[model samples]
Target: MDKIKIDIMYLFGASGHGKVIAEIAETCGIVIDGFIDCDDNKKSVLGYPVFKELPSTTESLVVAIGDNGIRKKIVDNNIDAKYPIIIHKMSTVSKRTLLGAGTVIMAGATINVDVNIGQQCIINTNASVDHDCLIEDYVHLSPNVALAGNVTIGEGTHVGIGVCIIQGIRIGKWCTIGAGAVIIRDIPDGCTVVGNPGKIIRKMND
Candidate 1:
């Protein structure tokens, strides 16, 4: 039988998040082909060649930008390509958990049983999602963010670094939970929340 050849995967963005994903891919024994970025001035990122555009015949790619909106835009632009779910070797993901395409679980992240993480999401370093949590598409859970059991995070939401949400709380779509914020109640859609108890500082229309 002839052996099947595997094409290398490329990481998009070529920034800090891209570098981290490169390391994680390397740890998983997956060779990174290179990086594709809009910035044409730079040559390489983390020793990998940076390309202005995705190479011809490119198939697999992962968006590694930290910003949720930028990542969403990049994924939307390249909707035809294959987006693989990359989980760091150091992270703990429950067998019952469901992770969608283009989701990256960074080092030291812990996802308990029955967690559902949506497409193009970022479970950043040292983050923890307790049992039965529902995290929607394009959500970014920053470093050290913790979510209790049965919590639901809506699509395109950005949970900031070191923030903590209480059990059974529901956070709506396109919301921004500020860093170090303590969420004690449900948050509405398209709002910017900050401080303890996670007050709504600004709405999307403002």
Candidate 2:
């Protein structure tokens, strides 16, 4: 059988996250060119060569790092040239879901019916976005994050890992939710929330 031509990409990190991204890419029929990382010791991961510099032949990049703050930084550094692919071969995204450009959906992520995901958003591993969820531009839903039905997440909002957002909650734009936060009520724009039941621990300082 003739091999299918696919988008060539390199994952930015070579840890567990990188392997997960590579697996997703494989499932999506994408060709992984290599893995790139600053750590020199990661010369090879899962049989793919490690690259300290960007791959000259590849056009797409996948930021496989899990940390949101660090991931943002990595994205900012790499996005100067290469286009990043938002891959989610195992994701159950509805036909009604609107996925924006430059978004990356990793494996096991579920974008339910009528979910609106904005541009440059990162829907990471095992995250579930329920029906009628509105995710604005540049939002990052970390691993294991769950949003119930009818949740509205504003632009540039970063929902931390293992967060659980209840149904019908309207999270304002640019909010930062800490890990394991359980959002039960409506949160205003620009708030930084943490802990169970999600208190406004830090207001918009900037």
Candidate 3:
């Protein structure tokens, strides 16, 4: 069977994680256009050209950067959204797993065997997402954010860098977790949580 070909551009990352993004693209039978990186010393990675400027193309792009803030910054650029790309291959998704377009799964970010991750989610560097998890659209699992088995996450939620969610906990939509927060309970919708054990410090203005 012949696979459909798609062109994907990766931005805001280089080195090992970027290579993983490329690897997933290759595994999915997609072609990588190149990379856009902020690193000055890296002109290219694994033979793919790196640029300071994002090229004017409608082809979909995956933000492979590890930092949550940088990833958000890179995504702020306005671009045509007609062609959405998916970078997946090494992902251990079950047949039931549902992933939307323009998502980037970094190396060692596990989606479990039957997890459902939504569109444009950033399964960031070294994050461990366990089995049967349900992650909604635009969620950012920051670097090292660990979700135990069966966790249910709301849409557009930002799990902070190194935040740990216990098994089966439900995190509300558009919630923000501070760096290193440990989530042991359900968080209400539209809130910001922080500290060793996460607590809602302020409600979201929206």
Candidate 4:
């Protein structure tokens, strides 16, 4: 039998998160060329070589790091490389939804109609974003998160696992919503909110 050849894309980061993203790519039947990481000592990830520099031959890249700031920074630096939007085969995304480049919609996630998800975002396993929600760039929606209709999550925010945001809530940029918290009102930028009816536990220093 003739060898089946597949075009492979490059992945950035070689940590645990990178391994997860590579698995997702595999689930989608996409082949990964290898990892392009800054760490010289890191040799391989999931059997694929970790290259200090991305090969010129590969045209596409995926920023797999979980940190919002780092993900944004990497994408900003590699704007010339093609960033493919990756959606798990099991995830249900509406036809009307607009997903930006390098976003990963993980398995069992459900994105309702007219949702706008920005670049390099992570919609993790079993998360649900309801109708008309706006998820900005580099946002991380952790596993099992539920966002009600019309919720607007700002850029670079991290919504923790099992959190629920009520309808019409606006979470500001660079904020952190702690695990299992229920967001009932607007959260200001750079604040960390936690507990039921989420309250600002602390505001991040600029």
Q: What are the models' TM-scores? A: 0.96, 0.80, 0.68, 0.93
CA displacement after TM-score superposition, residue 114 of candidate 2 (Å): 1.6
Global lDDT scores for all candidate models: 0.92, 0.81, 0.74, 0.91
Lowest-scoring 10 consecutive residues by lDDT in candidate 4? 1-10
Could you give the candidate ranking by TM-score, starting with the highest?
1, 4, 2, 3
Question: Which runs of model 4 end up more than 4 angstroms from their true locations?
Answer: 1-8
lDDT of 2 at 58: 66
lDDT of 1 by residue, 55-118 (tens): 9878899998988888898888888999998899899999999999999999999999999999
Model 1: lDDT equals 0.92
Q: Can you tell me which runs of candidate 2 are displaced by over 4 Å? A: 1-4, 69-86
What clash pairs does model 2 have?
86-104
TM-score of candidate 3 versus the correct structure, residues matched by position? 0.68
Of the candidates shown, which would achieve the greatest TM-score relative to the real structure?
1
Clashing pairs in 1: none
Candidate 2 residue lDDT tens string, 23-115: 776676667789998897889998999999886676677777765456667667766545555567577778888887557787789888889
**Residue lDDT tens for model 4, 1-206:** 23222455888989988888888888877878899898978998899999998787877899989999999888888788889888888999999999999999999999999999999999999999999999999999999999999999999999999999999999999999999999999999999999998889899784
Model 3 lDDT tens row, 95-152: 6667776677765666667888876687877788888999987788888888999999
